[model samples]
Target: MRLTDLISPDAVFATLKASTKKQLLQELSDRAAKLSGLPAREIFDALLHRERLGSTGIGEGIAIPHGKLGKVKSIFGIFARLERPVDFEALDGAPVDLVFLLIAPESSGADHLKALACAARMLRDPGLVATIRATRDHDALYSLIAQRSKPYAA
Candidate 1:
């Protein structure tokens, strides 16, 4: 369940400009719609409902907003680097600038969990996070994420 399995080059946005968490999710949902062929409104509504249960903000300037959709046949991801950090109600109370939005088929139970765990572990790497923040090019960001997500060589 590597990040590459869920995200492609086209799914990476290096500099997304949004003023609030809701705006960020909306933008991500719009992008996810184009990538996943799912309706943007449905995606947005699902994400909002999930957030109402609890904030996905995991601290250290990162947030993983995710949801399941009946229309999706497989898991999909969209990665974005915010142009400015915004309050996300993070547990640490820190603002978020890096976001990974994931959507999975409603029936993908174990696969969805594995993908989420893989993404969370990958983003927890401080070195990779720093590299991602240092670059503003979408291609570079995508390459960094994809390359770093590979299994570590012994």
Candidate 2:
């Protein structure tokens, strides 16, 4: 799946402010609620429950927080670039500055995994991450993530 397929221009954010992981998740949950028409508290609780399982912080200053919700009809994602990195208990001990929050319908099993894998692969590209971090323009960030670009740079 392509990033553009899962994320919309309105869902892309830059230089978001959050001092802690919980606050960050809360912000994301609130945004997701507006986009998905679900209760913000429900989304927050779902994300919190997932975090209790283990940190989604996949290292290299990135975190992909995801959960399945019965209220959501399909998979959707929100990408946010934090104004400053925050402690996420990342496995590699790196604080997270970039986050991609994904939520899917409860019945979307295989589709959810595919979306997660797609987001992971995109963010794993160091060059792409650098490009994202270099700009605060929401439109540029959206293009960088949404465009079907060439091979990932090393």
Candidate no. 1 TM-score: 0.95
lDDT of 1 by residue, 7-65 (tens): 88999999999999999999999999888778999999999999999999999999999
Give candidate 1 misplaced runs (Cα > 4 Å).
151-154
CA RMSD per model (angstroms): 2.5, 3.4
Tell me the spans in candidate 2 whose CA falls farther than 4 Å from its real position: 148-154
User: Which residue pairs clash within candidate 2?
Assistant: none
Which lDDT tens digits does candidate 2 get at residues 88-113?
99899999999999999999888888
Model 1 whole-model lDDT (C-alpha atoms): 0.90
For every model shown, the clashing-pair count is 0, 0
lDDT of each: 0.90, 0.89
Model 2 poorest 10 in a row by lDDT = 145-154
**Candidate 2: C-alpha RMSD after superposition:** 3.4
